[model samples]
Target: MDAGCVTAAHRVSCHTMNADLFKPTPERGPHQSSGTAKNARNKPEQSKPELAQVVTDSRTGRSYSKGKLLGKGGFARCYEMTDLSSNKMYAVKVIPQSRVSKPHQREKITNEIELHRTLAHKHVVKFSHYFEDQENIYIFLELCSRKSLAHIWKARHTLTEPEVRYYLRQIISGLKYLHNRGILHRDLKLGNFFINENMDLRLGDFGLAAKLETVEQRKKTICGTPNYLAPEVLNRQGHGTESDVWSLGCVMYTLMCGSPPFETLDLKETYKCIKEVRYNLPSSLSPAAQKLISGILQKNPSDRLTLDQILNHEFFKGFTPDKLPPSSCVMVPELHPPSPAKKFFSKMAKSLFGKKKSKVEKIPCEEKEDRDISKLVSGIVKCSINRQISYKTVGPSEVTSPTGQLVSSVPLEPTPAEEESRKSISRSFKGTMASGTEPCEDVLTPAAVAETAMKVLKDCLTAMPAANRNPPCLSRPQSFLWVTKWVDYSNKYGFGYQLSNQNIGVLFNEGTHLSLCDQRQTVHYCLTNNKHFTFAANSLPEQLRSQKQIVELMANYMEQNLMEGGDLHCEEQASALPPLLLQWVKTDHALVMLFNNGTLQVNFYTDHTKIIVCKSSDDSYLLTYISRERVSYTYLLSMLKEMGCTSELRHRLGYVVQLLQHHTDA
Candidate 1:
């Protein structure tokens, strides 16, 4: 028989071979032998009354009302039972007397109850009181409403890396506790890792648990879910804490890869594979994950990673949320760790500016030209104009107008009058923001800003020359603004970026933006792209507190985990406001960010190459490129246009333009 059949028999009869569990009892027919009919008639009738709705404990004389069935195993059925007097609920496992009539079968139930009731740990399922009636034995356990990891795995075939880390930490904690107490959870699998309503994991199902024994005296019983069984147990050597660790590895593999590593159509094949430590590690798994799995799944039981070693593995060194949201039971969770940086910055801010003296300034829809000009300067128009002029040499046919209409092919060189008009627009835009005196009615709207940026990038890519045979070596500028670090958690929260000026910004998935500026003492929030708000870091409004927290989490994550992408540095400048992200586009190959301060950044995925274009304070265009080696070089756009760049930089710029065009088309 296969391991499944063996497990079924073990559950039904406490390891006794029982073929009757797999098939129904046959009914006697007219042709049946008279002796057989007599034997059948003498046997007790299997049918019985439905279990009493109200079960009274004979020992304690306590009455309980049974609710709906929770689950069932071969030897018992579990129900949600409430104490009639106290109105308290419990998960009651009801095992019928008929199932455990044999002395050894009854001993198994007693052993499980005795072992489980003595356990007390946060990760272990709580054990309540137990009692017996004439017809059933009721064992109460902690109620876990969300069910088990098995249910979650069924809903989400595989979990993300961070989530895997989150769950594995808890599982290892519980396993370590058991090991410390000289006990073994022989059956370790997704089905046994119960999840409570609070999203906390509790290791339950101790039916197969046993006290640790010396190797010579250990019970060589091959009992556990077949797919998770250790080779030593199958070889009848003995069960040890290492066997449980091996099973834990299988559980981890099942949760991460969506199936147990040694699962096979034939149970024998599975056992064979386990003995040989044969399994395929998918390339999709991170290197840390692969290493951890391999470390724990070693063929020799002694070679397997201990619970402590597993917890300290490199895989766990990554971001593991302290807790998971309850929604994670059915869907992916949007988890944001409490920001460590927020507290540090808050303390520093209090020392620099007294807590009572800090102020919050909320800009209204209509403000003075100077006040609004500050907002405009920290907004999108500057970068749009710089990008527009930087690629003015592109032929009209290849350029897209700000309105997204295709330009007609014509002599693309600008006439003197047109050149003068372009210069006038730039000067006027900058002068109004600087002097705060000019009332500019031609302010670009959010939609117009996005369109203009797209046009400028497309034009630049179309006009750039083909890649050169060698990289260009030229004297570059000393300083410029660009992204030094960034992380894409777009699957949950958003895309986070750190500027060379020590400013951090997160372009959220919901179309809003939050930024930390002024040495992280001030916060800037934008909604619907145009409406902006500012707050003292320590005194943010209740409505924006959650977003501020999320930005801080991203900021802390990048500060600790990610290295700066380039060496170019721009020291913090004294400004009333910081630049806000106007628009961001993500492609399979790269992430493109556009800022109101006239900065455009494109980060490529495959090689970690980056291209940044922005206007310098000198009314000149600057382009910065960070190569795959993380070396940074900054040049005037005029220089690049005249001297040309190497193929590496040229191709990435072309890709950014293509992505913009595709985004516009979409």
Candidate 2:
């Protein structure tokens, strides 16, 4: 086998790599174009077999006739293709295996597919299926004939408030769906924001997407264009869904003012402006648009307006998200460097410097609460002081500065804040600290223990375990008052409450701002009211956020234990989508698709389900391929059964039984 070609047998050896290999190290020069397949790659369709080139999917045996090149990007070149059997059209993204042979790159591709698979809304781009061959991976997606919003933005330097509102509503809807599903679109820019022929803005190019499996989860990767990055992201402070809100504010500003609020000639100045949270609200804009943008452009992610609030703003007086029609798309003039629809590859995060053609300059996004220049500088100082600088030993000798002056082995005296941080960590894990019997000098090398100690301190700060950990469910036996009433259960095992449905919403809404996943998905019920309530989330962190499904799960769990039956049957929700039978649900680990399932309760990305698409007018459906993990059919069957099934679903279930029985009749 070739040195670069990955074999399944050597998979483990492939991932244990040098730590530095994962750093955002920019490729020094022009990228090497590696796809050499004469038929699958660059050759024009006219020169290929017959009138058009034909590509067959090995997994499903479906065939697509390649048409024209739609655009090109860092990892893949997209083309317009026609499904021969259905005569349907799509944009196929072709990525060579060599491009994703490495573990991290492969992980990225898998995540992108997973995220795209779970997201389903009128405003989000629809992902169909992914087909792979030995040399390349082909991703099938909805064909948006209008190219992207960047084209429109470039053509019309600034849009009228009405036009901005038109696009804003659609964008927000898609974002709301993503946030509800515990996913974040880290990268948001006009270039990656696409629109279909129906003038509907569909968010796409989720190469920087991530999942928030639990409520306490937060992401640290500094992805997204420098210009569109939230302040917390730049500060290397943990970030969540609110970061996307900040980016949306920047995009909203560009829609009204021709460019991002703080557009500088280069990234440094933009970053500086963002750190200070400096920007001017255009007086010429409508009061509603100005007020909304200003609110969204707030320095603190906590202060930003929620998507629901934005939707209800005075600016959208006559416009409602559901009422928005699919009008013919308005194609604007194209921007510089040709196609503005540049998507991400694992290497995109490294495209900030030197010679890559894609190394174009970036703009800055709206940011956190008002940051004093001193505070910004101090934050940098704090980051530098705490960072773990890797050290290697040549000999057990005294450390020295570059000037050859010897350095002290002991830790420096702590400042008041540092002392506080140490005290807090000490309290959290008092039993783990050493007693006075220990030696005066610490035995661990500074380099050897620096990384580990910092991780502990970080975990202490969040009051949450490390990312990979599934900490035991909250078990505090403490009690608290609910308004004026006395709830007997003060300390609960999980995050459950004892209050009325109305009161529950009132209390949950207070200080519980919308946030990224912060805890495991569990249902908490109020014994007093005998009802479960869900809180609407917002772009603002700590605003009310609760899931109705959680209560449903709790209800099911209780009923399941009561009966002698093995599993509890799903009780249909009065407000849920009109359920339909899953024409087919793939049991394999690679993909899961349910056809003709009516509108979903929510767009969710989890082990239980990653909604590919709701029932379609064409009656066709799509799904995502699980690469890193595989789920069993029995588990899938039980999960769906617990969630409840429509008559049609049972109909299909009977079809399967009959199909099995028919074999015996023959």
Candidate 3:
């Protein structure tokens, strides 16, 4: 959106999947190396992929058992693998040596590893470790199973001005981290950014990252995704960090307009439009947002606003990073997490984009890939849960994807007022910090301050007497705040994510304890019974009371497993329910049910879906919720979804109910 927008800072929490890179349409077979000779490449010629359940990492010497395929793109395929030692599941980017055959390609990977290893920031994806076997290089990454900005924008159309700032503030913070370390991401796109369960926007896919010895040393590499590429890169001019600023402009525009400004079927046509600085600046954007976009999209690299200047812009008046979740805590998720289906959020992210699961292209037949996955449940929920890109027009610019897919684009007439608009918003601040440079009053934004304060508190808490300490419980990292948003929309109690282990939401917040709102923000799910939670008791017919039982068990299980820690594979958790009543679910947690009478129904949670046994008060016999003869699995799932519960949650409950209905309880 070439129009105006504002800035605001908020906390986020979540995980991610892919890196932003061009998907090369390689015609070669899996065993072939296209660019480099098979014999001379770094890979061992005869060392084929072995059919083994476990593979040892050449770097850490740790072995990870392979799980399901997460996604495949560009040069590699990512897999869900369990660290045999820790039993902690991670996403492993398995890049065949066939893909890294070229010297330059190999160096890029090396540079990526080095750059990722040296950096640590909340907005950037955390790299755990990496190693190479004879056939492939395994890059172990923090598994982020959330929507990318691209996925969200495609569904919702565009973000509101406040939401724009909400995402952009973190993007800037992440870039600032990389810039400070003298690393040039080189490639920045909607696909490269992800919102974790925390709601924080993360800058990921550093495969094309570059390292500069100093800020002044410019690199003349003409590499980047076509749409987001800066003009300087196309012209073969030596470029530095300023190039990233241009891509950021594209990102901001896309967020506002719901489409990239310069996409076309032909790359040359796209480049031409960008070079000419043509765009239909939407009138819908606030003056501040328009100014921000126009200021950064300058054709000349030197003419764009610096990161510091952008942060200080009037658009960011209410921006506070403290509201955003810390990235460090969002990393290292628990094992065998829930699937991130095409979850969307327009008018409740509208309809879920049910993308077909394309199989991971290459798997050894003798060695099988784990197909055991939880039910795929996604799509944003209300308060009408929902969800936007970029620039220059070429004859009422028509939208197009990389593969020549034609889509609608917003076209604007090339008006003189728009030209003047562009000219009016020229860079307000230029160049690097110098001897007489103006000191930014906002150099330490609220988020930075809060982060620092939290660190100090952490250190102090470490030294405190165990019995005397009560550290504050924070909320989970979230971007869209879906669960909270649902609570607000559905007027129900919220559950799912927690800011931290100790900080689970308290359920009695709705009306019963309106005073709780006075204490802190209202969360959808609250601790109705300490670890137990219930809906806000909104008294609405749509409230999923059964969901409370499901979530409580889920929460209890998550907490217990968390306390146990390391190498605790979720599958190893013994099912408390019997096999006759067990159910397989795709959610991060399993839903089990029990009954003593119509009134005191008990629900249980398991790591995976399985028939679990219920322990009685006297510790003697198995129990069932016998109050009502049979609760139809189909009816329950329908009501759960009708109440705005996620598909993952609803499906888990269905599995156990199905078992109870069909098996005829003994």
Q: Per-candidate RMSD vs. true structure?
A: 25.8, 30.9, 27.7
TM-score of 2: 0.41
**Candidate that would win on lDDT:** 1
The candidate that achieves the highest TM-score relative to the unseen native structure: 1
Q: What is the lDDT of residue 351 in candidate 1?
A: 90
Per-residue error (Å), model 2, residue 383: 72
TM-score rank order: 1, 3, 2
Per-prediction TM-score = 0.46, 0.41, 0.45
- Score each candidate by Cα lDDT: 0.66, 0.45, 0.45
lDDT of 1 by residue, 1-666 (tens): 000000000000111012222232323211111121113234554553456656787666676656556665556677776664454678888889988899998999999999999999999999998988789888999988777888788778789888988888888889889999999988887877889877899999888899999999999877777778788998899899999999888888887888889878776797799888899999999999999999999889889888888888989878898788877877888877557798688888889887565457766634433433332110112222111111122222233423243322222355564445334444434421121111133443323333555565555555555545323533656455678888766557666788889889886655456789888888776543133455578865444667788898999999999988877777667554566565554443456676665567877666677878776668676667777778877776655655566645555555555444332322
Give stretches of model 1 more than 4 Å off.
1-49, 337-666
- Model 3 error, position 279 (Å): 1.4
- Judging by lDDT, tell me the better candidate of 1 and 2: 1
**lDDT for 438 (candidate 1):** 17
lDDT of 3 by residue, 93-160 (tens): 78888768899879878877887877788888878988887778988877655546765666555765
